[model samples]
Every structure is written in C-alpha cells, then in structure tokens.
Target chain A: MIDLQEMILEKDRLIPLLRKLKKESRLIAPVTNKHGDTLLSEINNIDRDTIDLDRQPQNSLKSFFLPQQEILAHYSVDTTGYNFTAPEAAKETIYFGVRSCDLTALLYMDLIFSKPAKDASYYDRRNRSVIITLGCNDPFANCFCEATNSGPYLDYGYDLQFIDLGSSYYVAAGRRKGADLLNKWDYFFRTVEEEDQKIRYQLFLEARGRFNRNIQVSHACHKLQEEEVAETIWEKLAGRCYDCGGCAYVCPTCTCFSVDDMAIDDSHGTRIRSWDACTSSGFTRMAGNHNPTDRTRHALKQRFLHKLKYDYQKHGKASCTGCGRCVDICFGGVDITTFIEMFTRDAS
Target chain B: MNTNFIPATAVIREIIRENDTISTFRLELINKRVPFSFRSGQFCMLSVPHCGEAAISISSAPNALPLFDLSIRNAGELTNAMHQMKAGEQVGIRGPFGTPFPMADFANSDMLFVAGGIGLAPLKSVIDHCLFQSGLEADAVANITLLYGSRSPSEVAFTTAISSWKEQGIDCRLTVDAGDDSWHANVGLVTELLQKELITKNTKSLICGPPVMIRFVIARLTEMGCASHDIFTTLERHMKCGMGTCGHCHLDGKLVCVDGPVFSLEQLQTMDVMELGT
Candidate 1:
C-alpha cells in the first residue's frame, strides 16, 4: 500500500484518475460548458469534459455548503395541529480542482456555521462532500490571497491538494479520506522521491512571488480597528454602489439569509431560507418601517466594516479570503481591493 | 436545509386584544421535546403560516411554564397577518433567543421601567418577573415603578392586567402622547413624567421605546444622576435567523440576536459603530 500522505501522479495517469473519481461519486469540477462560460459543475461525461485550471471559477465554494435557497421543512396545518418534516439527507459528492482561495474560504464558512449555534443543514452537506484542491502556481491578475495569508499555496483546508508539476502532479493528502482515495487507486500514484520534494519547494517559492505585493489587507484591517474612517470614503463608495447585491451573491463569506414560508395549498407548504444581502435596504428594516442604516452609504460602510474590521474583532482575523472574485464580478465597481487602497492611502 | 431554521408548532391558547392594531398572544408549544423556558427580554421568531416571520419579544415573565406571551402590533406584512390570526390557530415559533434582562443585577435595586408604545412589550416581561416572584425573590426588589406611554389612551396594551399589577404593589404610572376625553391621566410624553418623579440613588432604570423616545429618556436619566452603566435598553432589528449565524441582526460585529437585544449604555458605548453613536 502506498503512503497516502504524499504521492506523485504522472501526466499519463490523469485521465484514469478522473474516470475513477467520476464513477465512484458525484464529481463537480471547473468546466467550460457549451455556452463558453466556465463554472464549477457536475461532470456527467468524463471523456468529453475538460477541466479549467487556468482561471478561478466564477462561483465560490459556498453553494456546496450553504445553498442559495433550500427548504428547511415541510409543514401542514389542519384541525388537529401542525406537522413539520425535515428535508431528505444530502448526497455524497466530491468537488475537485478547487483553488486554495476557495478552500480557505470554506474554512471561514465552517467557522460561521458551526459556532454559537450549529446549522445542521450546512454541516450535513459539508460532511458528505469531499474537497480536492489545486494549488495556484500561476496566480490570476486580480488574485491577492497572499495579502490575507489564505492562499496561492495552502498548507491545509482540503482532503487532497494537487500542485502542478511539468510532467507530473505533486499530490498530498490532508485528511484520511484523501489517503483512502490514494490507497484505492494505488497504480496511479508513485511514492514521492527526494528530487520531487526539491521541485515542490522551488514551485512554492515561485508561486508566492506571483501575487500582487502592493495590497495590504492586514494593515487596512488594523487601521479600521484603530480609528473611525472618514464618512466621505463611505459616501464615495456608496455613490458607486447600485445596490444590485451582486457582490454579496458572489461573496464567499457573506452568509446573510432570510426565511419564508410558502404555501402549497390551504393545508400544506414548506419553509425556505434564501440568500439575503446586507447591502439591500430591506435587510435591516423593521416591521414599523424603522431602519437604523437607511442610506445606501450607511449600508455600504456596514458591509466593508463587517468584512474588514468587525470580523477581525470577532474572529481574530478578517473574513475576506482575497480571492478577488468580487473585484472581477461587481458591476458597481465597489470592490474590497479598491476600498483597501483608499483606506491605506490617506489613513494608515 | 438547516434543522435549526425549522420552527416548532405553537398553538395560540389566547389572543387578548390590547388595542386596534396590537394584541397579546399566549402560545403553548405542542410538540416540545424539552421544556421551553425563556427569561424576560429574550425574543422568539414568530411566523404566520404563509405570510412570513418577525422577531417578536416574549412579553410574559418566567413564571408561566410552556405558555408565553407575544404582544404584536399591526406594522408590516407578517405582523398584519399575525393580527388576523385568531385563537386556536397554529403559528411557527423558534427561540426565546437574545440576551435576557439582567434580573440578577436588579435583585436588590429599586427598579424603574420606562416604556413607550409597543416598546412596553419586552419591559412588561421584566416588570412581571420582578413583581410576581415567590419567597425571597419577591422581597429582593425594593420597589417597582412602571412608567408606560402610548400614542393615545386607546393604544395602551395590557389594560386588563394593569389593575392586578397595581394591586400586586407596583407603582404603575400611565401616560399618553395626546389624551382623549376618556384619558383623564397625564397627557404628555413619558420622558416628561421622569421630571416629576424622584429617582433614588439605588435605582436602576430600564428604558424601551421608539428610538427618539429612548434617546430622550437616556438624556433625562443622565440628568437625574443615573449612571450610564445602570441604564439599560432593548434594541430591535429585522431578523431571519434568531441564531448568530445570520448577519442581518449584526450591529457592528455584535449579533443583536445573540450578543444582545438587551444592552446597557456602557455596553453600547464599547461597540465602535456610528449608528449606535455612543
């Protein structure tokens, strides 16, 4: 039996491993569909599908743990009483080729759902899912995970991780399940040699150099905690914000949600929890139409403060993963990187 | 789907009409595996079948087991639907969440409760708990002073319980913003009532009202020599999940559902947010 902790996979063995992963469990990977948009989607035909490792996927890893919308319970009311039944169990699936930024974001999400009160549904999906991450050897233009100390090359937060080598892939197991996968498919992996270790260390250093060095995520967080930022900065950010809620929808760490009970008929229905954004005016508005942060600027400030400052105070680290997905997707041009630039410009 | 978001069934035992738009509902948990117990100032997510849910405070004190009160006003969609709900109908309920009032701290202090409009709901729980305690717990409180105000005489909640509350040795003072012919009592704001009343050195003031009313009351209490630490208030925000997981109820990293719905002036001061304006 091969030691599953660290192993090497040849370029020729990649297709066989993919075929095995697809047949064993539900496999989701980054693939460009017929529409020419690359997304993390289920692989039905392994032979036809091509995985995209060049760029970060458009969507984050949140959907696998916390879905955009899900039914909490099925309810029925009659003359006797009310009855509520929990939804069916989640299916076991494997998410492959996830980037280090998403893997780190998953860790942040795990903390949010488990602490204070356990979200059973989130844990259910999380427990059943297997994550196989891919190391970022060539970082994206907007990528700055190094600033948050979350990625580029992750030390942890995956069952298995793959660091790309020219002729072969350096595979390492971070969990028991990953070791089990290697044990099951022993023919695909060879034991790591001394030369492979030297190459891995060299690749790690080169990957570190590829990130944007100007971004200072931790410094901005420190400045936010020390003193109040100017209101003009918030106003300027708010002016550009259209309140489209796209940033939150695309955000990996934003976990705000609202529950609604939809009726099937007079007697039966289901209660659903859908993704809700804090940037929206109606998020904090009370029943009597009393809103504390009524202005768009106030909401904008609240979002950044929660991400950059408030989360640091609560969790001892900022919530942002520096994936820069929001930077790439936000239509209003309200990005965290820009805010960090503005914050560090005059304040710190 | 999270089982934590699933609400247990609560049967409405009694619906007491407090006013035209507001009513006090007494609910009993039908399928509770564990006995439900909540202290005063904690709230529950009250949901109508098909309408929606709102974070409503538990109005009744801790004495009643299983059965609790939620005084709701016809303010928005979910609340308007709740008002239309009759006794014997079923509604969804989760929690008794948020930080409870500091009952232990106020044990030996002279209690001053200042309430305005629907803000009186949560404070009523604290007041009832203080007055209706058994044995040494009852004697722990020096005296109970309740200053309640509404928009009009007709809008006063818990009218039926007022006489009994007074009989139980509570110094209940009623006021209205503008009084009608029937209202022979004080025809001024509740904060003005604080001027005429004398506050002792050993007093702890609990104020709950509209944001404007709360601000003025806090100002009055400060002038009356009440320390910021001794004054407490309950805050309200739109909440979907009563648990801290949901970020909707967050007031500058402090999840109102978990960290507070109840916070002292000193506690709010420490949270460096502009809206709190500490």
Candidate 2:
C-alpha cells in the first residue's frame, strides 16, 4: 500500500504542481477569462492563464464529459447500406478545482447512464478522466449543498479532495489515481501535522454553519411520495416558467438527453445526442403531434418530481445535490428551492 | 463501445398495404445474429436512413421466428419515409424492447381483443399469439374474440388476417364509425360490441386503440364485471431510445419503454397517465 492518503501542500506550490501534472495529461481547471467569469477551461500554458480556485465556475463538469451536442456516431448512407462508426475515444484529462456538489452530481450521472445498458459515448469520456474536487470552504451565494448533504466537504466519491487551510491545503486521496498523483509529486507536499488536522475540522464546521438557505429537500421528497403536490402549485410554477430550458442546462444532475440524426450530404451524416429538458413540450412530443403532458400545468411537474419524488423512491437518495445553480439561473422565481419551500409549507 | 446506438440492418421482404394510410412491413434480419425473439406487446426502435428512429410495435407473434411484422401507419416523418420504401430495401432495427404481455397467465384464460384504427397493431400480436398457443398447448386458450373498429369501412385493416381467424372459429366481429354503400356490417364504436357475457373475470381483455376509445372500452369492461388486472393494453409514447434512458416515455415514476409498453388496467389505475381520463 502506498499510504499516500492525507498530506498538506503549501498555497504557493499549487500552480507549479498543476504545471507538472499538465505535462502528462490535459489539465482542466477553473480559469478566469478576460470577461471576469470563471469557467473550467483547458490550460494552454500553465502560468499564462489565470486559474482561479477562489470562485465557483459558471459551469459544472457536465459539458466536459457529455458535451452540449456531441456526435455519438457517424453514418454513411450509400449502395453499401447504412453503417455507423463511433466517434473517437476521449482524451485522458485531469479535472481540477471542481466543487464537491458538482462531483456528487457526476456520481448521479454514473447511476443514470448505466441502466438497461451502458451509454457508450458517456462511458467513453467518463472512464478516461481523473476528478479533483475543491471542498467549498466559503460556500457560494446560491449554494445549499449543506442542506443536500453533498458538500461543503464530501466524505467520498472523488479521486482527490482538497480543503484550503490558511497557508496550506489539506489533500485527501479517495482513489488509487489520486494516490499515484500524490506519490508522483511527493516533494510538493508535506506530512499532515496535528495542528493541520484541528484546523481542517474547525474549517469544516465553519463551512457547515455558513450556508444561508435551509431547503427542506428531504421533507419535500417525503411529501411528494405521500401525496401529489396541489395542482395550483404546479400551475403557479408552470405559469411563471418561460420554457427557456436554462435551469436544465445549468443543472449538474439533469442528465436527460435526446438523440437525433443530422445529414452532412445525401450520403453521410452524424447521429448526435443533445441535452434535453423535461420542462419542454418537445421532450415527449411524438411524431404524430401527440404529447402526453400538457405543458401548461405539467411543465415543471416532471422536473421537480423526478429529482425529489421519483428518483428518491428509486435510488433511496434524491438526485438534487443542492448545488443551487438552478436557483441562480432561473429568472422566473421557480427554482427547486422554491418548489421545495412551497411543497413543504403546504404539506406541513 | 459504439454498438449501443448502432442499429442492425434488416431487409424488408414484403409490404402489405392494408389501406391508404396503413401498411404492414415484413422484415427479416439480414445477419440473423443469435436469432432475434420478442414476446407479444414488445416493440422495436426502427431507423430510417435520413430519419432517426421511432418505436413501433411488433405486430407478429414469436412463432413467426426469423420474420416479424411491423404494422405502421403513415403518421410521422420516419413512418411516411418507411411507407415510400420498397421491398428488398434495408432499414436499421434495434431492440425488441419493453415489457411483454404475460402469455403464461393468459394461456389458460379466454381472450377478448378490442382495437381501433392503428391501435390494433400491438393487440394483433397478442391475438395471434393466443391463436398460435391454441394450436400447440393441449390446455390452450379456451375461446377468442376480436372486436375491431376502424374510422370507416375503408380504414379496416388486416382483412386477410381477420378472414383467416374467422375460418379458425374465432368470433371476429368488426364495426366502423362511418358506413359506406358497400358496407353491410354494424356501424358504431367498438365499445358497443362489449357484450355482458364476454366481460367475464377469467376472460383477459387486451385493448389497444386511440386514447379515447381505450378510456371508453375500459370503463365499460370494468363496469360489466371484468377485473382490472385482467384488462391489459399497450401504450404508445414519443420514444427516442427504446431503452429506459431517454425520458420521453416517462409516465409518472415509471418509464413506459421499460416498465411497460404493455400495462394492465390495474397498473394504469395508479399512474396519472394521459391515456386515462386524467
């Protein structure tokens, strides 16, 4: 056993250590662009880009693993007959500065795509990646990961988890890949001291207390299981929803997608899978123009119920990681937290 | 890694045009890998060259092993494109997916089939399976009856199959919504054919039709003393992946693609499905 489990790295050694890791694999970290927004971007050069670990990235780890619109297979239609060839295998990459809630949602994605059969394209990208999550010391404004029990600091499901402790970082390796990374760059880190352990626990407690929103996620889940939400509640939510599909795009755990074939020429084209929102009428609209769900009353019904009610009953854990990205993204005031508040209130 | 979405090519052997809008395409897998088998009420995701895919029911019984029938109506882009395809042309086929009707339980019971327009596609699979079972099993399906209703006299499909069933002594009664000069049969909804004698608890009423007809037929059958679990019907949804992943066929907590394309009336009672009055 390597015993490369817990160690401390000085704050100054972060960039140089990432530069070393970048040489072997493609390094993706939260980088602050010129427009003043932090995003998880590929680092062209180690020191040239501004890798901001302080702010939460505008996007989750979804698009990196499951691109917005990726070609699943390329097909050629001619005299030879219709045949399809898969897209190229994913490149080996290191994902750095991900939040605990984001990584929690990735674990949920793993559960979703592996059913009747494994989604080939999703697995191709998911298998070749190393995830390094940054524990939220100072939680983001919209973050309710504390309520969801997915964050501030996660106990599991990350390759490597980093906790900022003043001048140094407390790094814990949750998997063999993370242990190898620690062993490979041993000089950048030092042994964890007794004082380091005390401060880490103290910071964890502080982070837990810092969350402003106390969403009744489990209460809502329970209420949904027992009785259906009042039709007026659904109507209120659906009435305000503009059907922009922005929340689903921003949400880390909403893994629903649609597959369609597009043509490049008369002979060849590609089969593509794109993100789909259950709120949209087109998500369930058949070819004959028959839609089972009336978008007026049921637009937000599927979205809320799937995460809180149905998924909870099926998985014993709700799909909502309480990242609260949807809370910030939805301008219509119909976020998951709003529904949960209304549901729990009405049920109580 | 890529075989998940890649559909195997199947050649269309024959196309039986039933009416102006409906046609039954007999397809055989060119490669015949492992020998594809599907129970009655299971469907396949058929792919057209330019068009993506649509979930269509396998209207044929398992006894027709290597060959299966897909009774498609000209309802959508892929279906319209399929209507234009000729015999000997190849099309992509993936899966014989979703839950199947429990033929073992049904083998001992009498069968009553109610169908409307293209809704007859999946019920036709069950009806034929019951007929096929009667020939094989010594304790076979006791009695069989089909009450099919079409939009009009011209819209009545599977006339050839209906004639064959009548010769085999199965009571095949049909009705049409609109009557023509040549039409000599009863003109009314198929629900009117629901005689009190046929609504026995032991008789499994398999229904597939328009949502409205299914609603009315089920109401009458239940009122006439048929048990909820004994009344089974297959559902049609806008499905992309015939597997459970795609959220298209999501009815309540259950995915219709996997949990069912075939659900009993008792099962339907729990869900807030649109097929019912809800």
Candidate 3:
C-alpha cells in the first residue's frame, strides 16, 4: 500500500492556518451552537476544540450549491417594450469540514445538474469550489450512513479529507487539486510511517461500532419495482403525513424548485427561482380547475415513493441517504426507519 | 442587467373576436426576416406591460402565413389587458415552452380530437397541422374527426375557420351544453356527443377541456374501447415560470412545464389523481 501523507500542526499553528485561509477565501467550518448541535458557519478564526465531529450537521450542504433564492432570469417591461436578462455570475467558495454523508449528497447533486439537460447555474458553482471533509470520529444515534453505503471517511467526492488523530491530523489528499494545495505549502506536512496507518484503521473500526443505526436496503431500487406491492400500503403510510413539505425542505436530495417573474416596473422586472417542495397543496393546482395530485395523502405518498422508488428506477440509486433529518425535522415525528422496516417486512 | 428575460417585440396584425370575453390575436414578429419556429401544441408565456404574464398556447399552425395566433380568454389580468389592444400594438412573448404534442406518434393511426370550451385553444394547433396539406401525405389526413362542444354557439372559438374546414369535407361534430332555438347540433355536455359512434376501436383520442370535462370525456372514451396509451390530454397548472425550476406545476415528480403539459393516459396512470382542496 502507499504510505499515507500526514500533517503535524501545533494547536497554535492550526488556528493561524484557518485564519489565513479565511482571509484569502470564504471558509466554512462546523461550530457548536448553544443547543450543542453542530452547524456549518463562516469561520474567521478556528478553535481546534470547537470542531464537533459527531453527528451530521443540522443543515445539508446543498445551500452552498443551490441557494434558497436565486435570480433565474430578469424581465423588464417599458412603454417601449419588455426585455429578458440572465442572472449575474457566482463567486468562488471553499466549503471546509463537511461530513462524508453531506459530501456524498453533493456528488448526487452533480449528477442531477450534469444530466442531459444541464443546469448551468448549479454547474457553475459546483465546478469552481473546493470541498474539504472531516472524518466522523464518533457516529450519532440517528446516523445511518453505513446503510446508505457511505461512511465517516471520504470514499469519494472530496478534495481533501482530514482524519482527527488526537494531537495532530492525518491529512489525505483525495484529488489532484488537494495535492496541489499541499504541495504549494510542503513545509507544513511530514511523511507518515507504516505504524501511523494502523492507528488510523483502528479509529475507523471503533467509529463504525459506535453507530447505533444500521439500514439494510441494498437493492432498494429493485425491490420497489415489484408490482405485487399494493397501493393501499402507501395510503396507510401516508395517513400520518401532514403534507407540510418539511421533509422535503430538510432533505439533502430533494431538488424541486419554482420560478416566478416579479415585475419591477413597466420596463424592468426580475424573474426569480426559488426552492419548491412537492409536499405542498398548491404544487399541482392548475389554472381553470385542474389538479392531478390534489389530496394531502396522495401528495405525501408521492413524495416518499418518488425518493424511494421512482428516482431509484430512473437514477440507479435511492435518493434518500437515511440521514434521518426528515424524521427529526417532521412535526409529527414520522420516522422513515419505521416505514422502511414495515415496507420490507410487508414486501417479503 | 441581463437580456435573457426580454421578450421579442411582436405587433398584432389582426384580431378575431371569438366571443364577448375571448379573442384570438394574430401577431407578427417586428423582425419578420428571422424565422420563429415552434411545434404545434406548445404554449408561450405572454406578457403585457404593467399587468403581468400568463401561459397561452399557440393557436395557429406552424406554417401559418404572416402571423402566429394566440387565443386569449379575457378572464385574468394579462388577458383583460390584452383584449384592449388592437392591430399595431406590441406584446411580449417568451417560450414556445413545454413539450409539444407527439405528432410522429399519431402517424398512420385513426385520430379523434375532442375539445370543450376554451380547451380547444391548444388543440387548434394540432387541428391546423393535421388539416394542412403541405408536408403531410394526402392519405395522412384521412380517418380524422373533431368533436367540439361549447356552452352556446356564441362561445365557440375559431368559428369561421372551423366552418371553412367543415365545408372542405372534414368530419366535424359540433355540440352545445344548452342549445338555443336556432341550434341544430347535438345539445348536452361534450361527452354526450361521444354516443354517436364517431370513433372506432382503432381510433386514437386526444381530449382537452376544463378538468371536469376532461375527466368525464376520458371515462366515456374508455368505455368506448379507447386504450390508455391511445388517449392523450393537455394539462394547465399555475406555472409561474415556463422553466421546470418553479415547483407550482409539479404533479408528483413530473413537472408539467417540462415533462409535459401534454401526457398520454399511460403516463397519467402512474400519477395520483385527487380532488382539489382535499
């Protein structure tokens, strides 16, 4: 095996490096809030002890890629006439301390925007940025990344991955860009020996054991295709759903959006695109009285089945990562774990 | 400042008043030297300055001379403003957005067109294309029928053009919801006209109307031996933007703006149909 590249930084040196990076680029890191939950925020300075490596961040990484509100196109109407204009360009960003699960989520978003009909705006932000992931040293109670075939360490989709090793960090370069960043500052990192690799492996194994939740839906895409599964079960599962669209809002994979044209004046207007959720009642309401999926139960059923069944059939992977954000965020506490357990047993 | 949202200037060349509340405007792009191509059954987002925008389908054939036609029902703010305009007035047009009707799929098949009220606006594009003898073989127009219904004779759209097609020996059936003393056509809901056995087992049906009419017509067509794949319908939703970015027009995972405003019954079967405000 190749010798792992390692970096040794004194607590004082690490703080200074984070501060220096902040000056040159937009740097985001996980910081613990008053409630003890970790959230990714803009960091001007770093406290090594301030990093919370346990549990997924409260928010998904999608906000960095697809903002909540973006100007899609602009329209201006004047006595002379109306004109259409595209939105302004985006800025470069560096997302630091992202979790492996969230990084995997970004990779899935790449597939969505890079499809045959490409979304240029999404592609613009994604391609220009740098992603730095932090390995999870301790798994949370709700995390089921193991079940989703993702984990604590960056298997893929990160520029650089930092493994927390008590006094120092074991930095592994996952991409050429990451390697170049290290090479440019070669004075900071020292070569890691064979013995250091054993300790890192041990930590990974212990971290795996700490995770309480394990999902087992290996062939989720294939299982949902069985015609024998009755539609009545969806009705039963949907009974408890409130149709508030909270699950979609918190989901890392849900990418639905809506566009609106705001008339600024007679000659000028702005057409804005904002995130939309399928769980809302107005999602399918047509003009002059037509709505195909008008019922709350039906909308709820479609939201879950689309993520679990339909998207998998089309994209070759389930859209859900078993992050349990939807479960925790829901007002009704409608846990997806319960549904998965019930659906698997019923299908068998 | 971006130019992407700016609509091209198109002048109204002619206006055909369909009813007291509805009219079809024939618009010519000011720069007629450039070709503006759009398929039949595709809708455009029309904008009237100071009023707002509305999704309106192209009502004329692709090869129609001089100007393209937009049939507007003066119910909304944009359409109400549009009704006041006359020839030489300029309006903004965006799109030719959404998926158009699958013309190639209907080749060599016996076709049936069912329309009710203003739902005929979008279907008129298909009707014009099929009736035109330019590119299509003479045999392709055979075995076609149009079943049109309105509340009254006064509410019927494209009356002059439809009568001309009827005079040209096209099989056209007209009906009214409540007929007057002068009315000679079948009188009832548009679905009642289906009882006349105008369609055969081999006919492919296309239905467009209000939701209530579409649902009733679909049930009647199904009863008349129309298979799910052979039946197609157009849907209209609150489309704030013509792009799929807007979530308003979504029906399940499908975006009506992108996946379709037009879909076959086979595609609709996968969707969940529910009552409004439930």
The residue-by-residue lDDT of candidate 1 on B1-278, one tens digit each, is: 46686777899999989889889999998887577899999999987877767899999998976789999988988888888888888998888799998888887788999999888899989888887763475447788888988999888888877778888878888999889889988989998889635598888999888888888888888888899899999998878888887788878778899998999988887775333444
Candidate 1 lDDT over A140-215, as tens digits, reads 8888889888888888768899988888999998887888888889888999999998998999999989876458
Predicted structure with the largest lDDT when compared to the true one: 2
Question: How does chain A of every candidate compare to the true chain A by TM-score?
Answer: 0.96, 0.98, 0.89
lDDT of 3 by residue, A60-171 (tens): 8877777788776676655655555568776667777888888888888887665434576787777778787888888767888777766767676678888877766677
**CAPRI grade, predicted model 2:** medium
Residue B267 C-alpha lDDT in model 1: 86
**What tens digits encode model 2's per-residue C-alpha lDDT throughout A1-348?**
535499999999998899888998898999999999999999998878999999999899999877899888888888987787778888889999999999999998998888978888888888889999999989988888877879999898888999999899999999888988898898999999999999999999999999988898887887788987899999999999999999999999988888899989999998888999999878888767878899998899999999998999999888998888898899999999999989889943
Which runs of model 2 end up more than 4 angstroms from their true locations? A1-4
For model 1, the docking class works out as medium
- Deviation of model 2 at A324, angstroms: 1.3
DockQ metric for all predictions: 0.69, 0.76, 0.38
Error of 2 at A76 (Å): 1.5
Global CA lDDT of candidate 3, please?
A: 0.73
TM-score of chain A of 3: 0.89
lDDT of 2 by residue, B1-278 (tens): 65688888899999998889999999998864466989999999998887888899999999897899999999888899999999989888999999999888876788999999988889888888888778776647888989999989989999988898999898988999989998998899999989897766679999999888999999998889888989998899988888898787899999999999899999999989888988
Mind listing the fnat for each candidate? 0.71, 0.68, 0.41
Segments in model 1 whose C-alpha atoms lie over 4 Å from true places? A1-4, B137-139, B272-278
